[model samples]
Target: MSKSQQHDHSPLHIFLIFLRMGLTSFGGPIAHLAYFRAEFVDGRKWLSERSYADLMALCQFLPGPASSQVGIALGLSRGGYAGALAAWAGFTLPSALVLILFARGLSSLGESVSAGALQGLKVVAVAVVAQAVWSMARTLCPDAPRITLMLLTTAGALLLPGMWTQIGLIAIAGVIGARLLTPVQAINHAPLNVPITRRTGVLWLMLFFTLLVGLPILTHLLPWTTLALVDAFYRAGSLVFGGGHVVLPLLQAEVVPTGWVDNQVFVAGYGAAQAMPGPLFTFAAFLGASLQGHPSGFIGGLICLLAIFAPAFLLVFGALPFWSAVQGNRRMQAALSGINACVAGLLLAALYQPVWTSAIFGLKDVALALLAFTALMYWKLSPWLVVVASAFIGWLVL
Candidate 1:
């Protein structure tokens, strides 16, 4: 098929396609990738398997939600920058809306969802995160050295337990990896036909860093709550590596300690997010709507939803033009390797503190969590089904 005929190349069409998936794609990031490949590669023939794999690899290397970045990249390839936005909107909005409503219900009705059901959600979060840790550890920390790095990262994160500490550990891990580790040689893939020029790509990169560095300073000096909100969520989005699950730790660090969101609520919302279909980053919408003070509704949800995702948009667009050159850099790959290990470590730490300590209060809670984990890990049941069943169990027993 001709290039024009192979892809619709219409922003609206792209939005509608992703919107459908946003509603129906129940599995997490890994599953989202499979869905994307089936639709865009096998069904639509928008790109060849090699090109799609290349895109996925590039997104995996960059820091942010991988599946969302892939969607944005695909949109950019087919529909330009506008298409990227449409793709993100289509894929992101459904879950964001659901989470926002969930948050609103919690805020307005306080006990609309029973404490047991909410606790069940929190218990399920433990299983979800444990699965993430297990899966990522196998992939990112295979060798002894990388495993040591992950263990040390977990130790440092637990001892220090803050956003800055997590950042410091990631940086330190990268340095260690760059100095000590040797990455496998990179493979070459067919060039992606993205519309962005390298010069424009450079400009986007500059803007990404500018906002990354400048936003904190701006928020510090100005004391505008909204800007602070932006700074927090943007930083969370900017630094999240590994996968959507990693965002759990980064976000809990950003929102929970600051009194912006309650810890219990945060964990509950995370559980709810797992049940939702789309990017788990839409958990930002829940945190936003659950904010303690001003801007704690749809408006807050919009602001935070945009802020957290903005980095992904900028990074994916900016990096696409330069991916070919950077993808093969040995040191860069090594650094990403270290960062991924540290990310798994961070999640490990989080699974202990907020997710485990809060939810697994009694032996019954422990039993429910184990059951949920078994259902997720072995039975291969749908996550939403597990979530609903866990909620019912929590209501019935815990």
Candidate 2:
């Protein structure tokens, strides 16, 4: 069928299509991208391969979760603004809800079972993040220059150990990339059919920045916990450069220091999130629901979930109209290359700090993490299965 003839332009149809994928898609961001390609580009003939690649590139260039942004862009292409939202909701809500429930039920578990399971989750997180670092290093830090950038970023982050430090490193890396690095080969793709006008795009971009800057100021002035929650989550969502995994360090810095969520709980939720089948950004929902104080339960989860994802919504809509103009710019690509390498380094730092130190207590934990990593990297076992097995082992043996 022709593209137009096969396409279902209704927002509801878009939601339903993504909802199914939300429930079934696993592996992680890269795997999610593959699933999107199969279902949208090939199975449904929603768009051509080139268009899909174009959308993926645009999403990669932006800050928020790339897979979710790509889904939003795909929805926008077919169903307009509402479709974009529908796509995000469909792809995000299943996991968000599941994580929220996990957060709520965690407290009710038997003490020993909870401790064991949580430790298992934490151990698996170490394996998952280690795998991410290994995989991203292979892809993002391919050459000596980028490898140096990655190593330097890791060192700086480990030494400085704060959110601002990570952001500063990313900015510096971008500048270095633009000045020192050459752009990689580019693939030409068809123009995206974004329905948003430049004028609308500008307004969306403005809102994105407005929230980024204003939320912190508002939280500081008002002393509202909810607003603070929004600010922290929003900034994490906005500043994230690489992918969902990169958000780990940002979020730990945000919630852990403030005493909003315990460090152990944070790492445990992150591990549990790995078992869920959707954008890892739903990890925000888990954090929100697990908040220590007011607005915590379902409301907290909803607020944090929306706050973190708001930037993704705004950026994809805002950047779409302008993407065609800048897509071919070598300098822009170079800067992004540096930023990605730094992000990988940031994740490496995170793996050591909260994911590793918090989880690995002894030889048993080390064995479990190594086993999980081997399962992921060599055996190619499904991540969810590894997570489950790890949790069971923790309960039984740890």
Residue-wise lDDT of candidate 1 within 1-398, one digit each (tens)?
67665557778889999988787665566556655765676457777654565576567667888889999998888888889998999999998998999898854434466777767867776777676577656666779998998899989988987656866787788788788887633244345677888899999999999999999999989999899999999999998776677788878888888899999999888877876778999999999999999999999999999999999999987888887566457787676677767776876787787568877889998998899889877886655567678888888887
Model 2 C-alpha lDDT per residue in residues 1-398, reported as the tens digit of each score? 57654457878888998888787665567557655765665457677554565566567667888889999999888888888999999999998998898889764432334567667877877787787677667766779998999999999998998656866887898799899998655344346678988999999999999999998889989999999999999999999876788899999998999999999999888877876778999999999999999889899999999999999999988999887666557787787677778877876787888668878999999999999899878887656567778888988888
Q: What lDDT is obtained when candidate 2 is compared to the true structure? A: 0.80
- Give each model a TM-score: 0.64, 0.64
Tell me how candidate 1 scores on lDDT: 0.79
Model 2 misplaced regions, further than 4 Å:
1-7, 106-190, 325-398
- Candidate 1: where are CA atoms >4 Å away? 1-7, 106-190, 324-398
Best by lDDT: 2
* Counted clashes in each candidate structure: 0, 0
Kindly provide the TM-score of model 1 when superposed on the true structure, using C-alpha atoms: 0.64
Total clashes in model 1, counting residue pairs 3 or more apart in sequence or in different chains:
0
Weakest lDDT window of 10 consecutive positions for candidate 1: 183-192
